[model samples]
Target: MTQSKSIAILIADDDAEDRMLLREAMEENHLPNELFFVENGEELMDFLCHRGNYADKEGYPLPGLILLDLNMPKKDGREALKEIKEDVNLKHIPVVVLTTSKAEEDILKTYDLGVSSFITKPVTFASLVEMIKTLADYWFDLVELPKNPKL
Candidate 1:
């Protein structure tokens, strides 16, 4: 297994406000990690595959973790998660489903599709900040993540 010392997170979401809010949450909590954003699954795929507009390393380094939203244009998280988990080169990257949906079927399906965790997006900014902080504390500060093995 191999990996980078600097932790990186890729957030795939279509909502502009939500993206800004998430960034603010991390900033408020004093969380220091590289953050990448994609508005849709197609953009995310380009970023991950180093294709088209995302070919540069600064624009598209493989992320350590992915925070995915369920619904969006071009492609959705469910579709993206399935493709990612199926890809031999990309399957090892831990993905956490962060969405507004609390539907039981969505929850079960995401987990079954190999999402590492599933979290419902909270309404308030304060709650969301807490969520991100807790996630950072656990995933980055506490839990020992598997070293990304390059195939």
Candidate 2:
């Protein structure tokens, strides 16, 4: 199924270079969905809960998908994933863990915390673009995501 163009994607990552690469990869894939970024998990929660700088709900619509990094400062992805799964309003959003770590513990932990999918960051830019394309195809064209109610 083709997803709505307005369905935003929220990405939580601390490394600026990684975020830039991800953005470039997404651009290479020519994804139609809107993309938003947060420096850390704190900002991610703020965006999701409409707190602090994210108070304007219209300006920051709830995302249909979230790409989270595991080892961010000031509340990591694991904590954020737990909170997202626990919250009734946010639990429906599909969260995919995209990080550099390949530790089995992190993988198992994130899965236990209710992450939809976990992908290790690819080493090459070309690979990243391919990964992004596959991800977009699966999430935006294949899967049926729940419609989020306007806040």
Candidate 3:
């Protein structure tokens, strides 16, 4: 895989406000990566598998990294993470659990399920901006990720 193509950051979150906040945080941090949103785990899976609306590869490019929210209406992040990790085509993408849950069980379970990291959503917007900056720094600048050939 080549790193020349632009890769998006796929985010799965049920809350509209949270998604909006994340987008604003990304903007504040100057994270230029394209961002995609899925309301639930089922939609996230659909997007990754290139099913339904996500079949248009050019419009919905495969994400290099996933920002998953654990709690959702259907199929939650735990199930989505399991499916992504189990799938051969999608397993290479790094998944980071970004959620409001600070539960020990959620953190431990996500890590055990092969999540790259589990981060609790910061309450303040400034903190979120910093978190997004750090995340961008690590994933975009520091690490070399597999680029999607289909893009």
Q: Candidate 1, which ten residues in sequence have the lowest lDDT sum? A: 1-10
Give per-residue CA lDDT, model 2, range 8-45, as digits (tens).
Answer: 99999999999999999988877887889998889999
lDDT of 1: 0.87
TM-score of 3: 0.93
Q: If scored against the real structure, what TM-score would every candidate get?
A: 0.92, 0.97, 0.93
User: Candidate 2: lDDT of 109?
Assistant: 96
Please tell me which model should have the higher lDDT, number 1 or number 3.
Answer: 3
lDDT of 3 by residue, 1-151 (tens): 1231366899999999999999999888766678999999999999998899899887888898999999998899999999999988898899999999999999999999899999999999999999998888788877898766553
Q: What are the RMSDs of all candidates, in order?
A: 2.9, 1.0, 2.5
The best-first sequence of candidates by lDDT reads: 2, 3, 1
Q: Give a tens-digit lDDT track for model 1, residues 34-142.
A: 8999999998888888789888866577888899999989999999999999988789888999999999999999999999999999999999999998888778877
When 1 and 2 are scored with lDDT, the better candidate is: 2
| Model 3: CA > 4 A from native | 1-5, 149-151
Looking at candidate 2, the ten consecutive residues that score lowest on lDDT are 1-10
Better of 2 and 3 by TM-score: 2
Model 2: CA > 4 A from native: none
**Looking at model 3, which ten-residue stretch has the lowest summed lDDT?**
1-10
